[model samples]
Target: MTSTVGVSGAGTQDYDVIVVGARCAGAPAALLLARLGHRVLLVDRATFPSDTISTHLIHPPGLAALERWGLLDRVVGTGCPAIDIYAFDLGPFVLAGSPAGEGFDVSYAPRRTVLDKILVDAAAESGAEVREGFTVEEILVDGGTVTGIRGHDKDGGTTIDRARIVVGADGLHSTVAKATAATSYAEKPKINAYYYTYWAGLPMYGQFEAFDRED
Candidate 1:
């Protein structure tokens, strides 16, 4: 029960994999898939140059992905150096690794508006058709497999698209999840007491003393 409202005589005519969310996870996934030569459709409820605030930290594993896509060059080309981790709790703290031994490696920070635009454009250039102001209303399923989805285009009205493999890149509040009930585990909630903010121009060492999530 997953599909898209194929924009009729409008933006991005069609696609093979229609990703619902275009930020964070969805955007990157679409770009990679498109590079592999799939007709990818990238959609987002919000338009680019949009503001998204959070603890925007991508350490280690994400760097590996960037390396795979060869975007590490471009991201690093933006001038943010890799973050050096230093854990601090009781005192000057423990450096995650020896001065020249073990530790995680990753770049510091980049604004969402700046970074996401790069990813968005990369996906589009990779051949994924990216669009904004499109919202998915339901997942179209013909049987057991995810088929396609239906949503509204920016200009208005419902659009329907059928794909062989529909990816539910739409996170958390994903319409695909509710439509198919794909998960086996029950969801849980946690009480968080952290306020996230961005600190540009300041040297950001990974694992600062402020972040204590060992609860």
Candidate 2:
């Protein structure tokens, strides 16, 4: 399925990039490309402000990227705390939050929903044509290279975006990666024997039980 919308360009002929997925990686990539003056089509399966399960830990690199994109203010304003590091010799830690690197904020911690929304907005602000509520159906190709993508969207109905570069930021199970024959997931990777969980929104407590999904 392909969505037909009022695509504004040099007569809807093509785009510089087509990014599948619009979360952390895809969204940032799309925004960066758009900021570089590339006509980008950013698609994702979820709408803005979607709920998700995550620790919302942003690495220093990601924080730098946000600042580079000039969206640092949004992040700070979203109540996402600035955390310097969590040096846990063993107990639930404290906010050792500090600015100790390159005069840049070396801290991060926010709800995944808030952080994700921030990135999604940044992608749009990067001049990327953002389309949410869309599922990537397939990666269009030619001569063993990426050409575009086809998918079904919520508002635009169906979508067939053509671009010179098609980036797969769709996460672990990536269709673009699969169709392009670029990468594969390995089942033999080391797995953690221990597990953990958090009683979010619950009082900052002193005691809690332990469990895992398989338990």
- Quote the lDDT for 148 in model 1: 72
* Stretches of candidate 2 exceeding 4 Å from the true structure: 1-13, 91-100, 104-106, 184-188, 193-215
* Tens digits of lDDT, candidate 1, 142-184: 6455567788987888988767666666656677667777664
**Per-candidate alpha-carbon RMSD to the true structure:** 5.6, 6.7
Number of the top lDDT candidate: 2
The lDDT values for all models are: 0.68, 0.69
- TM-score for each model: 0.76, 0.75
Query: On a 0 to 1 TM-score scale, where does candidate 1 land against the true structure?
Result: 0.76
Tell me how far the alpha carbon of residue 8 in candidate 1 is from the true structure, in angstroms, after superposition.
20
lDDT of 1: 0.68
Cα displacement (Å) at residue 191, model 1: 4.2
Model 1 is weakest, by summed lDDT over 10 consecutive residues, at: 1-10
- The true-versus-predicted C-alpha distance at residue 40 of model 1, in Å, is 1.3
